[model samples]
Target chain A: MKMAWKEIKKSKAKFIILGSIVFLVSLLTFIISGLANGLSMDNAALIKDMPAGQFYMDENAKETYNLSKIDEDTEKHVHKEYPDAAAFSIQMGFVVDGNDDQHSVSFVTSTESDLFENVNDGEIILDRSMQEDGIQVGDKLTNNQYSGEFTVKGFVDQKKYSHTPVAFISMDNYKEMYRTNHMQLLFIPGQDKAETINGLEAFSNTAFLDTIPSYSAEQMSLNMIIWFLVIISGMLFAIFFYMMNVQKIGLYGILKAIGVKTRTLFGMMWSQMLLITAIALVLSVSFSHLFNRVAPDGMPFDLGLETTLQLSGLFIVIGFIGATLSGIQIKRVEPLQAIQQGEM
Target chain B: MTAFTVENVKKTFTNGEIEEQVLNGVNLALKEGEITALVGASGSGKSTLLTIAAGLQHASAGQVMFQGKNLTNMKQEEIRKVRAQDFGFVFQASHLVPFLTVEEQLLLMLDVSEKRMHKQEKKKRITSMLQLVEMEHRKDAYPSSLSGGEKQRVAIARAIIHEPKLLFADEPTASLDSKRSQDVMELIRELTKTLHITTLMVTHDEEMLPYADRIITMKDGLIV
Candidate 1:
């Protein structure tokens, strides 16, 4: 360990270059991960925030939220069985504020329940994001399909769907706008096993999120980019260490001749790997979180602590594997060959 | 006293369909506090015999006895332990770790040998070793900054820092000019007598042979 540290101290430029690459790669990974997570929330915060449970829709709709429609009797039957169940409907539509400007929103309505916002007739509750666009409480809004103007009741935090701010309307208003007397889905929170209701298909919370339009595809592409960055960084890390080891082959052999155990040499490399990786991770994590803080509020970038920890753990494991792979050359080195190589 | 002996050591290298015998039944012994030089032509297997005796490589059929233990019968780990604790080596080209300072090189040698010295004693010993090698002034300098002779001096200092029982010098002066060669040879001879460490050296410089206590010449892997 002391030998490894001495090498690094004596050769700072090489190690700094390595550390910078790790920092850049890890920083990019964290940023991309944050964007993926933030976009996921932006696409379906309304559903993601809900407790774990099952969602039921029409079995014939074939795993689509918009096409799925639960009949009134089905909703009644589900509510009868689980009094805490919430029946909800969602449709993407536009609302005109007092300024006469049109804004797209995921119009939502739900039965009386604590899980969602329920407004009185002719009143609307919107995601707080809409408040930034000049919509305010008591402002009257209009939808082209509805006959009455909606008085904006209030706003809730992080209520979004399909990358649009959610606008919660009354069941009567939803019925009048979409001409739907029955809710589109039935949600029963906190149930480990979904009840077998006839004509209804059950979906876990995660499976239901996939049914959201463009949710899985968008997340899949972004997640693919994140994984690619991780893999590329791991390979780059291994190549860098491999190059370093190649240059030190003679030194390693001479050390072996002098009775330095191969394991000690490996420990040296590992300590260097750990020290460099640890320093880079700390900086990148700090910078990524700092970027989160200073970024524009409208930007979809949410780097959660849990996600950061998981990715950090992955980087360490990959770094270990990479460095160990390169250290194999050290074990194969022959001291006699090094002596013949002349001048380390 | 015969501190180490090699009996009928033979080594062969095999190609796809050919085998070349390098050391053919070589017999040798190194006396305590004596410097034995092996002089030979190129490909004469002097270095091979030296490496075999040093336990840096294995002989296909032979016994290498060191202090009552047969190195040929020992496992690699056991041989490594013996090398670390009882043997020191100086190669042809100094072979100092490029990134370590002269002082750090010696300290690392002590660490590798697992010497049980207090921190203060280790430091004092390093200081004295540097003085003995005439490298006290360059103790903080890295190998890159040192001249060829200075680097060899530091290498010698590192090899003896742990005070091993035997020292192997394979062309220790091969990279130096005549002046530096004589100076290094003189230092090795003086230290061998002072420390009472057995020495095994391989060289081709006839002018440098006078420093050895005894010289054995080899023509075809057999000493005459």
Candidate 2:
């Protein structure tokens, strides 16, 4: 093991080149992974913020949340069965500010429950993102279909739906504007097994998120990119270590001739790999976390500690497998062949 | 005393569908504290026989007896144990680990042989061995910094550091000039004599014949 470190120290340039390559690849992976996670949060932070639970919709709505309308009877039954349940409806719409600027939003209305923001009639709470568009608390916002005006009451952080800021309005206000009395879904918090109710389809929080029109497709593409990067980094390790091991074959054979254990040779290779990867992962993790803090407001890039740790662990394991796979040559080395080949 | 013996050793190498017999019915005995040299032309199986006897490769048939143990029937790991603990090797090239210093090379050999000693004692032995090879001045030098003769001297130091009963030298001086070759040979002869270590060496240079206590010639894969 000391010999391994000494060799690495003696041949600094070779190992440094290997380390820098790993660092760059891993940094790119962490940055891209952060983007994927951030975009997912941006797309559906409204439902994502909700506690783990089950969502019930009309079985006849064909798995689309907007088209699903739970009957008043089913909503009442769910509320009776689970006191924590809330009935809510979301519709993509636009509000016209006092300046006549039209702003797109997802108007969400839910019955009185702790799970959602319940506002009084004619008062609206908007996602903080709308504030950036010049809408402020106490500002009177109007809708083309409503007979009355809405006064912005407050703003909440990260409340978004379908890539649009959300506006929380009372059920009566929602009914008056949309001309509907039926809620689109009934949510019951903390149900391990969703009991079947007549004419209602139950969805886990994750399953319900996927049923959103573009959520699955958007996430699938981003997730595919993340996985592709992970696999590419893995292959990079394999190919790099393979080349290193090939160059050391004669040295390995001579070591074997002098009676060095095959396992000892493998230990040397693994130690070098671990040292290089640990340094690379540390740099990338630090830089990625730093980027997480300093990224621009418009850019969604969240590299959390858990995600960083998982990716770092994966890199180490992949590096081990890669270096070991390349080291299969060490096992096949014959002392006589190396002797015949001369100096390494 | 016969410290090592080979009985009718045979070795055949297979390359795809073709077969080549490198050693055929070769027999020999090596005495303790004696230097026995195997001399032959290219393709005469001297090197092959030496490697087989050193447990570097397997023979197709026959027995390799060392101190009453039949090494031919031993498992690969068992043979490796014997190779590590009881045998020393010097190849044609210095084959010093390019990354290690002259002193560190011998330390590695001691490690490979698993010689149990205190750190201070091990350091002392390395110092003495380096002085024996006249490489104590270059103890801290990496192999690349050493000339061919100096590197070969380090290789010999590494071989004898563990005090093994047998030393196998395959063209140990093949890569050096006449003066350096004579110096290396004289060093090997002196070390084997002083340390009471038996030596089996392969050499093609007839001018180097005088250093060996006994010389065996090979032709067409058999001792002649």
Candidate 3:
């Protein structure tokens, strides 16, 4: 083990090059993984934390509950029976501030109930991302399409859907502006026995969330990008390691001629790869955090410990497989060739 | 008794349809504690014979016995073990690993040999081996920093570090100047006598012949 380390240390330049490539690949992997997780969070943050065990939506609503409608009378009937039921209307659209600056937003209107408790009156709650658009408290933002003027009240941490920031408002105000007689959805908390009330379709919260248009599409798109990046990075790592092993063919021959077992040579090569990959992963993760700090607002990225661990495990496994595949070439080396070639 | 015996050794090479016989029915015996020189012209099958004896190559039709065990009947791994523990070789070119210092090179041989030694004991053996070659002071220098003659000396120290009974030297002094060549041959002879090692050296340098206990001259793959 000591001698193997010495040999690797002597070839520091080659190892550095290999390490750099692996680091770059690992960095890309980390970023892509973060993006995938961020996209999922951004799309579901509003509903993920909602205090509802199940939501009711029309079965024929196609992809989104926003387009689905249930009557006020039916909502009231379900509330009377379940006692914890709540009804809400959701609208996703764009709004222009007084300065004519257009910003994407998700508008939610909830009845005064625990399930709809996140909603506040004429004051609109904006996501922190809206700060970049120069909107602040006391500033008026309007959506002429919805026929209302909204006051920027305060900011929420990360409430968003489909890349748009979300805002909460009262149900009456929502009804006056959007001019709809029916509520788009209903929420029921811990009332699995609630009978099907008139003029409303019943669903579990998980099912209703999936019915949001662009939720699956958005997730699929981000996941595809993440998958592509992982495959590309893995292949690039394999190729770089393979080339380095090929370059050391002569050294392998010499070691073999000196009666070093093939298994020992394999152990050295694997250790070298693992050492390089571990160092590269650390560097790449550090660089990723540094970049995240300097990035401008709305650049979606979310790197959690879970994601980091997953990517690290992936790199180690891929690196080991790559090193093993490259090591197959060692068996082809003839010890006699080293004797003929003059050892350096 | 002979340390190694070769009987009717023959090696033939075929390129496409043409066949070339490099060695034809060559018989030889290498006795213990004697420095035997094999002198031959190029293409006289001398290197091939050495390779066969070292178990680095297989003979077309012959038997090579090292300590009365037929090398031809041994498995590949078994042959490697024999080479590792019982045989030592010095090539025409000094084949020191570039990454290892002179002392480390010698220790590497001891590490591979089946014989187990403690770390301190291994270090002491390496130190004494280097001292034998008068390279004790240069033990820490990598092969790249060494002069040609010094590299050859390190190579010799590495070869004999495991104290193998049989040593094969194929043109060991081929790359050195005349003075260095004579010094290397004398060192080889002295080490063989001091360690009671049987040595077979293949050389074309007539000037170094005086150091050999016996000489076999060859031409056209036949002993002259």
Better of 1 and 3 by lDDT: 1
**lDDT for residue A209 in candidate 3, whole number 0-100:** 63
Measured by TM-score, the strongest candidate is 1
TM-score rank order: 1, 2, 3
- Where model 1 places Cα greater than 4 Å from the true spot, the runs are none
Give per-residue CA lDDT, model 3, range B97-173, as digits (tens). Answer: 78888888887789888678888999888888888999999998998899999998888887888999988999999
Worst 10 residues of 3 chain A by lDDT: A114-123
Name the best candidate (by lDDT).
Answer: 1
DockQ of every model listed? 0.81, 0.70, 0.50
Chain B TM-scores of the candidates: 0.98, 0.98, 0.98
* Model 2 lDDT, residue B183, Cα: 96
Task: Give the TM-score of chain B in candidate 1.
Answer: 0.98
* Superior by lDDT: candidate 2 or candidate 3: 2
Order of candidate numbers by DockQ, starting with the best: 1, 2, 3
User: Model 1 over residues B104-156: C-alpha lDDT tens digits?
Assistant: 89999998899999988999999999999899999989999999999999988
Q: Which ten contiguous residues of candidate 2 chain B have the minimum total lDDT?
A: B76-85
